[model samples]
Target: MTHTPQKPIGSGFGPASTADEVIRGISLTGKTVVVTGGASGIGIETVRAFRSAGARVIVPARDTAKAKAALATMPDVIVEVMDLPEPTAIDRFASRVLSLTDKLDVLVNNAGVMAEPLTRDARGYEMQFAANHLGHFQLTCRLWPALVRAEGARVVALSSYGHRRAGIDFRDPHFERREYDRWVAYGRAKTANALFAVALDSIGRQWNVRAFAVHPGGIATPLACHMLPSEIEASQIFDAEGKPVIDPENNKKTPEQGAATSVWCATSPQLAGMGGVYCADCDIAIALPSDGSAEMHGVRPHAIDPISAGRLWQLSEQLTDATLD
Candidate 1:
C-alpha cells in the first residue's frame, strides 16, 4: 500500500471547527462505535457528535459510575466497565462489545494518562505506556474480528504534540534502567499511539479497516487533572482569570473543537481513501522538519516512520501477549 502523505488535503475545516460541524449532514444511523474514553472530556463530545448522527455508541470506562454520571444526559449511550491498564478487563470488554454487535464501525482509542509520577501496571510496564499504548494495542487486536466484519471501519488513536518530547526507548520502555522522567514517558507513549496507527493502517487496509492518529490540540479537560497548576500556567492554556483559553488557531481549543478532528477522521467522506496519517485541526497534519524547527506543530518523522511503527507493533504484541489475526 502507498503511504498517505502527512500533509493537509484542504478539508475545508479549520482548527476552530467543532465536532458538530465536522459531522454535519453525515448519518450513522445503524452504525456501532466504541470510544474507550467516551465518558469524559473530548471523549464525551466525540460520543455526543456520533450520537447526534444516529450511531449506537458504547463507552468502556474504568470507573463505570463516573462514566454513567457523566453520560447520564445521553441515556441511549451504552456504558460498560473496562480498565485500560488491566488485560483481563480489556478482554472482558471486547467480549461484551462483540456479543452486542457483530461489527464495529469505529473504534476510538481516546482514553489515556498523561505525565504522572512513576507507576507500573501488573506486568511492571510503565503506567502511561501501558494504558496509552499497550492497552489499546491489546484491545484493538481483541476487536479485530469485529473491525473486519464492518468491511469499512476506522480506528482513531488519540496521540498528541507531546510526542515531540521523546521517541520510543525500546531498551527500557518500563523505566527499568533509565531515570523516570514523566514528560519523556508521556512522549514515548504518545509516540506509540501514532506509530500504532501507522502500523495498523498498513495491516488493516487489506480488510478495508483503516486507522489514523489524531492530535486533539490542547483542551482543558479532566485529562489534565494530573498536571500541576504551575505546569498548566506555564503551558499558557489558561487565561489570567483561570479560564481555559479558546484559541483554535494556536492549538488551544474547547473540548468540542478538540473532538472535531477525531470525528472527522472517523466519519469524513473527504478522507475515504486515506489512512495512517497524523491529523490535527480537522485535517492531515503536515510533516515537521527534522532540524527541530517548527516543533510545536505537525507530525514528526519518528512518529510516522513505518519502520518504527512495525517495531512498536512487534514490541506491543510481545508485551501484551496479543496479536492481530
Candidate 2:
C-alpha cells in the first residue's frame, strides 16, 4: 500500500465506531499488553476490548484497590500499583515487568490528568507535564528493551486536540518563571505525548516497533475531574439539561467510542508499518491550522515536526535523568 502518513487510509470505522466494532475478527490470544489507567471510563473499555480479544492485559494504577474493584470481573487482567509522577514507582514497575515477561506486544499510555489546579511533583515538575509526559517518557525508555524484544511492539500515547494550545515551553515547563494556566499546561503535555510518538517511531522503527499518538474524542469521563461545572458548560459539550450529547459535530464521544482509536492503533493490520502520526476516529489525521476551531480537525505542524519531536525527546532525557538508546 502507498504510504501517506498525513492522510487517513480510509479506515472503515468512524465517529460512531465502538471498540468492539473496530476490533471484530481480531484475536490476540497470546499477546501481552499493558495499559496505564485501565480501570475506569474508556480505559476500562479499552481494557475490555483487548481482553475480550484474548490478550493478557496488565494494568498499573496508582490506586490498586480501586483498580482491582473496578476491574474485578475482567478476565486475563492484572492490576498493580504504579504512580506515574513518581520516577521511583515507574522504575520499580518496569523492573517488575522485566522479571515477569521478556516482551511486551502493546503499551497504552492512557492514564492522564486533564486541566487541574497548579500542582507539582516531587521534582518540582508541574503535575500535568510530570505525570502525562515525563512519566510516560521514563517508563517507555525503561521498557525499551522489552519492546525491542517483542520485535513488533506498538506503543500508543494518548494525546488530544488540545495540543493546539501550545507546544513544549522548554524553559518554563514546570511553571517556574511564568504564570500557570490549566489549559495551556494540559495542551503542552498533550503535545508532548504526540511528539514523543513521532520521535519514538523515528528511532524505534528500525526494530519493527511502531508508536502512535491517539486523540480520543471529547468524552465526559473522570478526565474532567479538574474542570468545574462552569468550565464544562462554557465548553458546550453537554445539553441544557447537563447530559452528554453524542454529536459528532461537537466532538462528543461515548467511552466505548473514545476507546476505538487506541485499540485500533494497537492491533489493526492496516497500520502494520505506519507510525508517528496523530490518529482520531480510527484514522490518520491531516495537518490543520491551530486556530482553536473544531473545523481544524487535523494535526498541527508543531505537533508532528521531526525537529520539535527530537528536541523534546532530548529535553525529556535531561529532565528525567534518562536516555534514549
Off by over 4 Å in 1: none
Give residue 77's lDDT in candidate 2 (0 to 100). 84
Cα lDDT of candidate 2 equals: 0.90
Q: Write the per-residue lDDT of candidate 1 for residues 1-325, one digit (tens) a residue.
A: 5778899999999999999999999999999999989999999999999999999999999889999999999999999999999999999999999999999999999999999899999999999999999999999999999999999999999999999989998988899999999999999999999999999999999999999999999999988888988999899999999899998999999999999999999999999878999999999999988826566889888999999999999999999999987
- Candidate 1 accuracy as TM-score: 0.99
Model 1 Cα shift for residue 314 (angstroms): 0.3
In terms of lDDT, the poorest run of 10 residues in model 1 is 288-297
The best candidate by lDDT is 1
Provide the TM-score for each candidate, comma-separated: 0.99, 0.96
Clash pairs of candidate 1? none
List per-prediction Cα lDDT, in the order shown.
0.95, 0.90
